[model samples]
Target: MAKEKPGDDKSPIAGTQSLDRALEMLITIAASPQPGMTLAACSAVLQHSKATTHRVLRTLVARDFLSYDDDLQVYSLGVANLRLGSEYLRRIDLRRVALPAMRELVAETRDTAHLATISGSDVIYIEVVDSPEPVRIFSRVGDAVPAFATAVGKAILAWTSADTLDERLPETLVARTANTITSRSLLIDNLALARERGFAVDNMENREGIRGCAAPIFDHNDTVIGAVSIAGPAAKVPEQNDSALGKSVVATAQAISALLGASPDAATALPR
Candidate 1:
């Protein structure tokens, strides 16, 4: 008989396996579309014994990472996690540094400007500077749009690594509008074009009456951290002036990136 291997056996890692399982349970709870998840539900999804799952969950509740309601018999993310997330966003430093530049961009173009970061398969707008024009476009600060269908999202995607893109983007793109790129090949081509031009454009791809242009913001490490965009009605964002608008947005994004300690050479190379 062959010697039994430790890998084949049920031996857990010394100090981290429990942490991993606890984190997975938290993720499962967070991912549920419903308001909360039951202990039995989490156990079923985790394929762990109910007793073990309960013990871990109680521990998480004790530490305030999750909240357990005795009356409802449900688990939800707790205030402690909210505190952690809020602190993480605070540390990003990008949002605080980009606001003035974004305001300037909006003032110059008389079009809405957005600062967004990629979250999973979507672009989450963290800041919005509204245009004063009566007919200008508007976007809420916390809203999300499909990453492949928006200029800001596409600008970041153009600078994303292949491995990260593979993990974040679905194989088949979802169509948001008639002009949205629905094929992987076409999206690849589109990103290539954006990379070459140093900015991205969305011509009624995300919505029928809107047009937008954006450029990626880089960090000190030369990593694409976020993007800045200018958006307006299709009539105002005419095809003839797209290049000029793209150049302006890229310049504004570069200015913001520089404030965040981005490399001077890298920032200057981005169509400024």
Candidate 2:
């Protein structure tokens, strides 16, 4: 006889009714949009009794994993997701490797530079370097932006695992500026470019007057650990003007990856 796997659902619905109901409810809510599904809608989708669904959602909301909008009667993912992601970074060597390089990039361009990582449906800032120019990048450490909206965010999103991308980038984009790539096809094109050229650019995508560029950084396993970017005003980024700034961002990213024990064989030039 074949050995039974632990926690396997092969023995029929004899003992895990509550767990099954809860998981089904969670999955149903995750599959919905507009912050979340209405409690009635969730019960309908999961085919569970209203009482079971309510009990599960209430417990999850209490734990901070889900939010219930009584006004709209919808349920959605909550702050617990952010907290869990923050905890994941707490165990990693994010600062030891990314900070020094960010500072170096800031010095080179006299513009703000930052290191960011993909965390669920957002891009979380892990490190930041301020330019001496008084004007600076809008993001700070621990700040997050939609993955489809920012230059470094898009770079990391492009390199992320497909499942992760699916969970993160919405089927439709959230428009932050008139130039933002709200179309999924256009964002995919950008992703293709980032993968092909080893860097990414945002020409007023996140903010009306902002422009930025970024590059991916890999770990010892060749996994893209994060991305780094330099951001400034639009008037500064056109042509070779800010292109020079982009080169430095790419260089800083590569250097940090090296510190993380990565040995990239592709282009690896540090901007002068």
Candidate 3:
């Protein structure tokens, strides 16, 4: 008779021990510091006999879920894993992934929170979480606003490449309000400041009576994908309180980025 597998009896569902072991092995291999693991190392880490470990590895290799390096005598993730990851990333809905964090931001700041993506020289509001306060900034989803005049746009633009900035920004930046930065040179300087501080501020630049703070969201590749912002009436979101609000916005943006597979270290890294 064949020997019983580990956790066979303890498993909640019957006949799942093999599947569980296979999944655990995959997780262990993926989390390893080294690029790959030898059969012996994998066996030791799994705390299973070499015979049992080899069987599992062979099955995974056959399914193209893992690859064996003949010369290195090691096993690593294979093309199948990449295919699954690609499918997962492709199906991800950015608006849905960012909604919870946006809600939390609105709760924390008592201001309207927005999730926006860049489209040419404009920022499109894809999602919004309204503040609970009686008096708050009102914004609608699908609203497109000038990129240079808003905190969300500045947050994303700060991390974008120089060529992209030049291509997107027009030769003449039309001012939306008295406080809007119309000069390209000055706006570039402001973006540098935003990159340094990890957040951006709109001090009545986008709208006369509104002020906002925002931070950029990154993806798995460490690219700036979007931005999260909290906006409110100037009285509530005062210029003096920008630092405090900025920290909140940055934290929220980082939280959203984490869901999108961006490491905290990568999120905090300086713009290239």
Instruction: Give, for candidate 3, the lowest lDDT window spanning 10 residues.
Output: 7-16
Runs in model 2 lying further than 4 Å from the true structure: 1-92, 266-272
Candidate 1 lDDT, 1-272, residue by residue in tens: 99987669655578888887898999899888656999899999999999999989998999999998888899999898889876764576788889989888988999999999999989999999999999988789899998999999999888888888887686678888889999888898998899888899998999998999999999766788899999999999988889999999999988987876577667335332
TM-score for candidate 3, please give it: 0.88
Checking candidate 2 for backbone clashes, the offending pairs are 36-75
The best-first sequence of candidates by lDDT reads: 3, 1, 2
Candidate models: Cα lDDT each: 0.88, 0.77, 0.90
Between prediction 1 and prediction 2, the one with superior TM-score is 1
Cα deviation at 34, candidate 3, in Å, is: 6.3
What TM-score would every model get versus the actual structure? 0.64, 0.61, 0.88
Q: After aligning candidate 3 to the native by TM-score, how far in Å is the CA of 24 from where it should be? A: 3.3
Candidate 2 lDDT over residue span 54-141, tens digit each: 8999999998888888787889987987797667646659677788788878787877887888887688888877778865656678
Which of candidates 1 and 3 is the stronger one according to TM-score?
A: 3
What TM-score would you give candidate 2 relative to the actual structure? 0.61
Leading candidate by TM-score:
3
Q: Which order, best to worst by TM-score?
A: 3, 1, 2
